[model samples]
Target chain A: MSGGPAGDSAIVVSDLRKSYRGRPAVAGIDLVIPRGEVFSLLGPNGAGKTTTVEILEGHRRRDSGDVRVLGVDPALGRAAWKARIGIVLQRSDDLTQAGALTVRDWARAMAACFPNSRDPDEVIELVGLADRRNARAAHLSGGQRRRLDVALGIIGRPELLFLDEPTTGFDPEARRRFWDLIADLARSGTTILLTTHYLEEAEHLADRVAVIVDGRIMEVGPPQTLGGRATAAATVRWLSPDGPRSVQTCTPAALVTDLAARFGQDVPGLAVERPSLEEVYLRMIGAPA
Target chain B: MNAAATLVRAPALLAVTRARARVEFLVFIREWISVVFTFIFPVLLLIILGSIFHGQRLPGDVDLAQYFVAGMIGAGLFGVSFQNVAIAIPIERDIGTLKRLAGTPMPRSAYFLGKMLMVAFVALAQNVLLLGIGSAFFGLDLPDTVGRWITYLWVIVLGIASCTMLGIAASGFVRNGRTAPAIMSPIAIVLQFISGVYFVFATLPNWMQTVAAIFPLKWIAQGMRSVFLPDGYQAQEPAGSWELDRVALVLAAWCVLAFLVAVRTFRWRARTDD
Candidate 1:
């Protein structure tokens, strides 16, 4: 009935646990997401990102422990909290059979869920779907379908949003556009929880990132420096008579300077780089070398 | 906010309910196949059956024209309340639409209430159409009292609620489109036959009369009969006591049990884990 409960934290889950019969999906996890920050939860398949999101969304019940979203216990949100949160599902719920309820109709429909929902056209524009506002939901291309999902998600003008694999089927350009839409929302002080298999999405959008594996949080930090990435080491690559070669070391700056001198000029095909977000993320998830 | 404050949020809830109602209505119109099946198909069945059995009186001297009127009326209500609700829901679930909505901040109860409201409206629409047919073709008499009208209205409502629950209950048990009809049709058809929607139960054998009495559909049809037919019709019919309150009470009980089953059995995910 109110906007949110009294608390500084946007979302707080303390030892939250949920099980399907006897097997735990979210096996005792504690998380505190600050308001107005874009946080990404990175995980592989069956790694509990969806279960945790579902629990936080109040769609599924937690068998034990305290879970709070937008300050109120989600288990007891009672539609007040639901009005302030938006969710962009991984799969499109395109009513191809339910004809011609256009973008405007959808926005109007979702707006009714909240007392103070956003204007439909503004939401359409926000999600880069203005051009297709009149088109039917089922007629949209895959990338455009993702945009519609974002449109419906933001139509409520939610304070917090949960995007589960939002750009999973997007092409490169659409993915970049979606990143901009998310960044714009973050700039407007809407806190977001993003879950994705695309490490690049996490690297690009997250203000803070958490790695989830085996139903556990393995690491949490900024994307650039997660999993000891900032100080873990760097790789220096250069063309060699023995073919292109590379070495990992802590002192990449010093190594690059030495390589510049040894090559007697700018090193041929030479590049000095820290590990990419994907590389670090893959390694953190324990993918094979 | 306190419970008092939540109660005061009625205006917002009304808006949400209205919006959902509009969407559902649009869905119905767009789903022309459902419209044809729910509305036109029943009308056709009535005409065909009426024509086939014309001139020859029912064994119990059952009014075939009035039977067509009553049965179609009940069938129309069942279509929206039980038939469409059951089928549309599973398809919606199989496609993950309900799970998608679960992610939104929409109150879970609002979803059902909105649906109930929508079905009630659609049933009203359906009843009026059938009422016109009944009056025009069968020399039907209007409800003798406002009380009878209210009684009939609520019976239709209860019938819908029971049907909706059956749909919801059935939706929980299946995960795909293939099994939806398989699960729904047999029970629905059986209810149609025994509940006096297609035939007056008095004409049936004694064993059937006893067996049909146990179901919600029987209560609904009996309740509707209490409204549409006069007291003399009951004496002639020789089936079902003319206890309007008893029928209402029986339906209300089934309604509560169905509501519980709907809530307890509801599954949002793709499949039953078991």
Candidate 2:
């Protein structure tokens, strides 16, 4: 609970618990995100990811435990504290009703809320929204609308940003572009905490990740090492003369070499496969294959 | 760091309020249907009803057109202040707009104040249009003396505050955007009838009169009538007098009560907190 200066870490939580009508949503969770790291919270639907993020964002009250964002306990975070953080909510169709105001106008208005903000047009360009700066928010396509959400979130030039399930409806190309935008933000030293159901997205962007299932953090690590994904037994397979043969082995290279020596030629359909991050995640969550 | 230093001393709350007000106003103006309904509908109703009953007289020798003009203005004020706020707030909540705003650095008071300012602006415009149409075409007298103008100002201010707060308080009952209009429209129509916006209060049943007297809409209508009607026309009122003191007292009390209720019950998110 005694994390140093709020400036040292973007977020710190300990023994956090929240319930909805006697149903536990986030139970005894603990986490710490250093400054400028991209931390992803990965969970299946109804796994308390949104609840945990909302609690950290100060949008929901916790039943018990300590929580801090930017050194201030979010429960007591006022406007001054709020100004230091940015939040792109799970679903925000705000300003769609204000169709007459262009994207730049919306950004300007949002920027005015913070103590220090990026130039509106610069933030728009950073989100790849400069071309449609004059377009009304209502007219933007779904992916474009999400980009605008990101633009608004970052316009405040916040020290920490929270993105809840961003890129949910994005196409493949749009999703990749969004990843780049987020990477650039991280490069510029803005701490990011993102929640997503997309495992590949978490793998691509997260410097560290926490997998939550049924209101608990089942595993926490870098994407490569999550759930021992890096060192898990590899499955070596080859098409033998009889049929396809496969074995799970600790040393896949030795298994492949023995198979090659026995074949005396290239092993047909030879393959050595380690479990993917998604597979490890699904197994950890106890999902039915 | 320099930017933060500069903004640390700036009136950041006021800036947030101004920005929110600007956004609210922009959204309001873009809703052309709302604009026509809130501002033009009242004047149109007055003109049509006034022309049809130009020379008609009510039970107490009150001219029907003149009285109707006053009533429509009152209704218009209620429409822009109370009905609009109540309906719009729930819609914002349903759309997650309020939830998003709640996460921002904008103070909650600044957000509500911004909405109130927009409502006040539209209410004032509706009043000006109604008064203009009434004076120019229906032979209604404008408040000429400073005292009458003062009364007009206080009545309008207090009316808008009370009605708008009540509207915000009522928004809590609307579960989502789709049901907001359905729930609010029927209630507004019923209040209009009971408050004598469309009919004579004295002619109504005693129970209906009592029901209307409990609400602020009735007092707002009575206050407007006091300002616009001749001194003798006060006899037509249910109280048999302008009762300006009671009007002020009732409206002020409602304003305070509604403000407290709204602040207590307001929800930034569509769903329950738990």
* Top candidate, metric DockQ: 2
Question: Per model, how many backbone clashes are there?
Answer: 1, 0
Regions more than 4 Å wrong, model 2: A1-7, A95-101, A236-248, A252-272, B1-11, B58-62
B-chain TM-score, every candidate? 0.87, 0.92
CAPRI level of candidate 1:
acceptable
* Model 2 residue B239 lDDT score: 86
lDDT of 1 by residue, B12-108 (tens): 6667778887887777776787788776777777667756644555543445666556766777677777777777787777666677666555666
Against the unseen true structure, what C-alpha lDDT does each candidate score?
0.75, 0.85
> TM-score for all predictions?
0.86, 0.91
**Candidate 1 wrongly placed segments (more than 4 Å):** A1-8, A14-24, A63-66, A94-100, A237-249, A258-268, B4-11, B58-63, B104-107, B133-178, B222-232, B239-245, B260-274
lDDT of 2 at B133: 86
